[model samples]
Target: MSNLVEVKNLCVDYITFDGPIRAVTDVNFNIKKGEILGLAGESGCGKSTIAFSLMRLHRPPALISEGKIEFEGKNVLEMSDSELRKYRWQGASMVFQSAMNCLNPVKTIEYQFWDVFDAHDMVSNREESIKKAKELLRIVDIPEDRLFDYPHQFSGGMRQRVVIAMALALKPKLLIMDEPTTALDVVVQREILQKVYQLKEQFGFSILFITHDLSLMVEFCDRIGIMYSGQLVELAPAKEILQSPYHPYSDGLGNSFPTLIGDLQEMRGIPGTPLDLSKVPPGCRFAPRCHLAKETCHIKPPHIHQQNECRLVACHYPINTSDNRDQLPIKLTQVAEV
Candidate 1:
């Protein structure tokens, strides 16, 4: 499949009183058309930073220090204001992490849905807007008449569904969802995600789902990218990641989640805290916490290299219990030939 979006050497920094703090560094990935890509990592690991950057939604303090966000061969970073406005909802739309709070408490759902239609000039007639709004509500399994109700009148899960409907209003080619299932129960989360998957099939839009929930990502997404301390440590198929994680951080994340089919076992978390972005070390970002780290890992940064045809890892020594563990630093060429 062709790529819907491609992000190259993306770096995002936050300007502070002291200096620039690296929130995201040298991140590169692409979302295939009609594919579901999930970004998983601990909090403050720049998962959301990448998401916001994709839509050019980063604010003043957060700057896109270095990067190229290309969608359909067009550079988003260099787009004009008029072009950006048209590109946002029509090309890509986002369902923010705080979906419930995104809605205005005082505004009726109909008016809120109309806002997107008006902003994008998608619908001029009120009757058309209402018709579209009702169709969206019905698609999300909500009663069409409920669009007239205030946000406060609906439950959190219903509000989230509303947000999802709003995001799909313009039939964006890519939908970036940042923790849309957060603060909701498991049942609700499953329902919302299942609905999203169904919609993706119906609308044929690619998805960039951001969340810390690795287990959830494994089940929902086609590919999973694991980030640590603002850098992508591993990118592979979701099941491949779940079955055999190459990077240490990815392994730690895999162990952190409970498995449904397994016996009850203690969850193991990575040993140390994440690196301080302000005083980032010279080498691998996860070296400070990685159990498999050697002297070379802490002294020099590891470049992203492919292990197999489909897997990419950024680690001098990827986690391996087999004979490869004693092979010192792995050579990418040899691994790719395996």
Candidate 2:
């Protein structure tokens, strides 16, 4: 399948008073037509940064220093603002983090919903706009009556449903969701995700789902990309990654999450903070905490190793099937068969 969106050699640098802080490195990935690719890692892993960069939403402090963001065979970075406006929602739309709070408190949900249509010149008649807004609310499983209510009047989950409805108003080909359901309770989150899953099937839209919850990503994503510091350390099919992670950082993340059906225990989060972008160390940024770090890891970051048809890992030691069984770390062994 051809890629719906292709990002190549992407890098983002944040200019501060002290110096430039690199938030994203030479990252390259693609979203195939109708594929849902999950970007999983901790908060500071630059998942959201990449999402923002794609929309050219980065502010003055942050800038896309190098890369090509291609959408439908065109370079997005070179597009003019007027040209970009045409693609912003009709071609691609983003459901942001804590998007519930992104709604305008003063405006009624219906007004907010219609504004999106008006911005895109999709609706001209006020009555027709209201009718469309009601339809969108129903699409997201929200009550039609809530359309007249202000954003502040609804609960967080309810407001989130409104935002999602707004995003779907255009039926964009690509939907970028950055923790779309993170603010809701588990039951609500599941319900919203199920709706999103249904929407994808119904609309035939591709998604770039970004989240730190590996378990959630595993359950929802077709493929998963593991990011450490600013780089994509691993990318693989969800099941393959869970069962046989090759990168040390990826292995550590897999081990941190408890099994959903077996144990039902609290997840042990990854230890230690990520490397400082301004003062990034030489070689691999994850070298300090990686258990498999070696002399080679100290000098340079390893090239991504394509182990099989689906798995890719950037590691000096891509753990083979048989490698010093006794010397292998406990966490690595446990997740190797997950």
Which candidate has the highest TM-score of all?
1
- Give the local distance difference test score of model 1: 0.88
Model 1 per-residue lDDT tens digits across residues 1-338: 99989999999999999989889889999999999999999999999999889989989999999989999999999999999998899999999988757999889999998888988788988899999999999999999979899988999999999999999999999999999999999999999999999999998999999999988887789999999889998999988776777898887877776665635666677898878888888888888888788999989999998888899999887865364555323212111111
Span of ten consecutive residues with least summed lDDT in model 2: 329-338
> Which lDDT values do the candidates have, in the order given?
0.88, 0.82
Q: What is the lDDT of residue 244 in candidate 2?
A: 70
Q: Tell me, by lDDT, which candidate is best.
A: 1
lDDT of 2 by residue, 74-174 (tens): 99999999889988898888999886567887888878877888888998888889999999889988889888998888887787778888888888999
Candidate 2 stretches with Cα past 4 Å from truth are: 263-269, 320-328, 331-338
